[model samples]
Target: MGQRVLFIGLNYAPEHTGIAPYTSGMAQSLAAAGWDVGVVTGLPHYPQWQVHAGYERGHQNRDIINGVPVERVPHPVPGNAGLARRLGMEIMFGLRAARARWNNPDAVVVVSPALFASVIVRLRAKYHGIPVLAWVQDIYTAGLTETGSAGGFATRAMRAVEGRFLRSCEGMVVIHDRFAQYVQRVLGVDPARVHTVRNWTHIGPSTHMDPATLRERFGWPMEDIIVLHTGNMGAKQDLGNVAAAAARADQSGAPVRFVLVGGGRQRPLLEELAAHAPRFEVLPSVDDETYSALLGAADVLLVNERPGLTEMCVPSKLTSYFTAGRPVLAAVEAQSPSAFEVASADAGMRVPPGDPRALLAGALTLHGQWVESGGTRHSGGARYVREVLSRDAATKAFIAALNAVRTKGHAPTRTTTIATLNN
Candidate 1:
């Protein structure tokens, strides 16, 4: 029988937010790459925290999407979830999950952030006597620590479980250097068994709309300097500071406009923070055409994070930012994985995390530079995204590593590691 891989994750499409796009993409691409790939995911519901309109909590759904078999199990979707409620939800998923609805003959790749699902995936692979890989999209405990999502006891318990699941895997794939360091030192995964697979822009190429025309269409002033951030406005994002920076810029009489786009549970908090700041605009997400237009229309693409959010998931928005051909102003920690990615890609400038003054100053400086250079494109990020960090590049590297794991009956060796990075 041909080698088969089963992917387990809580979030998957047709949910439009968070990690769904990437997980769905990976499963489909792996199938296209000639592996027998099947996905076990929860029913579609994500940042909204409610099952999408077509799905019911008690019913199961199955479909073949892009040649990948997907079995969607029903689980409670809490309107507002804390650690306890989230765990209860995972318990429901475990109760409802039948054996992965596929003839899996080889391996499994489990994604996190329905992190409690790890126990089920690990045990299932062990029972089947097949290899398993933990695809560490987010360093679980570190993220909870940064977000203050759980109490100390819960953090420790989650970490212990995560470590056991990771170490039990035949291999692990981490997306960032800081994640790799944390996992190796704290989680005790063998450095040899850990692999780093950098993410690419999951969304397609931008429409490359004319900046002036697009800005005018959106009712934005042609002369003002625009800084736009589009993505989930969760606690870890610290986007309240964007409103703060907008207030600062307005008080200083600078022609700077800050636009925060996208929806999440934190959107209400963001709206409250920006209520008095006229220059700060929090818009409900627009259509894809407008999204592509906004990326091209802005003078700068901005990223902000809460202080003490040192290393967690590398924000997926950076990959999208890199594709827009605009300079990025990253108001993030010096040691954050996002900071590393910005510098490594040579994409844009960085400031200390959660500092509104610095964020304001950085945006103005970037605006001035754009004016000074007569808008000569600072297109390093676009070039890097296309040539170095394209989706095809990530796919090629992952397949090679998967092939190695199948051949060796374990994680790829150092040789495969070097080659994958080169891809």
Candidate 2:
């Protein structure tokens, strides 16, 4: 048998969050590569803070997805309220994961999300004497502080906590190159311990449905040009500029129609704005089939990030946009890593965040160019995704990292025997 590897994350299977697909794909790939893989995650309750139907609260349940064993534990989903509730959920998962590790030794554990799971990783490392690979999706402390979501004493406390967590890890994996620099400069993390591995979007262009069929099913006009935004609609997204751009497109008598699909705290506001404007269409988040169809049906995939969010966030959807074979209109800082992808892929245009005029102008220009070019928005992004962001490439890199860590003689934190049962 190959080396046993474990993954710890807040959200996983049955959850349609960002980390779920990435984790599932990685686990499946690792398992197929002849490694013994196990996953530790909380019950699925994301985008909606309620436990998924058919799952009961308990220690955990084991299941196989795509040939890998997954272990799930119960964690509370604080219904979009207090920090204490959210912290409770994080702490509960951390403690349960620690217990699970104590029982199952010999598994190489990696913690994800970089915020709550970092604590679990530290505890497991300390208790089991295991090496942890910290996978950072967001620079949580900086992201929260810069975004004004955290302030004053809270920011200081979180920074100290997260800094310690980063320092405790055997190695760290970051999605963007700048994140490694940020870790070294801001958190004082060791430069040698950090690794930059780009995130992958496993979905490809072949999954796309016919545009006319998608339009007919969605009840959208085939004649109107669709500008689609799919993903979370939280504060970090800053979608007001998208609405403002739609309003501008309407004023110019353009046939462009804006479609905002996804749910978040900002969904209510987006729905309100769309309800008051005929040019805007707001839909709730849909399954992957519908999402792919919508992406295929649209002329452009719009991505937006609030000011200063580019450094803190690496929008995984950008990879999906590339995979969909559509141009992107990204409203993000030019200095962000996203800008590099846009330029490298020649996928689309970038406008300064929060500037409605620039956004409006860019959208109009791109729409016109796409139409003039016979509606060919292809920039070879899909090919780029297949070559660069494919599961094969990402899984190979992941396995290399795991092999490196294993070769270093890293061991699990603790080991205990459990009673064997026969069916």
For every model shown, what is its TM-score relative to the native structure? 0.90, 0.91
Model 2 agreement with the true structure over 180-257: per-residue lDDT tens digits = 889899999989778777788855554557879888887778777788988777778888988987888788877778
Candidate 2 regions with alpha-carbon error over 4 angstroms: 81-84, 101-107, 206-208, 374-378, 407-423
Give each prediction's root-mean-square deviation over alpha carbons: 6.1, 2.9
lDDT at 220 for candidate 2? 78
Cα distance off (Å), candidate 1, residue 394: 1.3
Question: Which residue runs of candidate 1 sit more than 4 Å off their true CA positions?
Answer: 98-100, 208-210, 375-378, 407-423
TM-score of 2: 0.91
lDDT of 1 at 215: 80
Residues 1-423, model 1: lDDT tens digits:
256877888888887556887888888878777778888889876666767787777767888887788888888877776668888888677555535453544677778776677777666556545576778888889988888988889889889988888887878888776888999999999898888777878655555577788788777898888999988877888887888899998899999999998877788877887787878988886656677778888989988998988878798888888887788889988888888878877767888877889999999887777668775635578777877777787788777656655544433343344244335
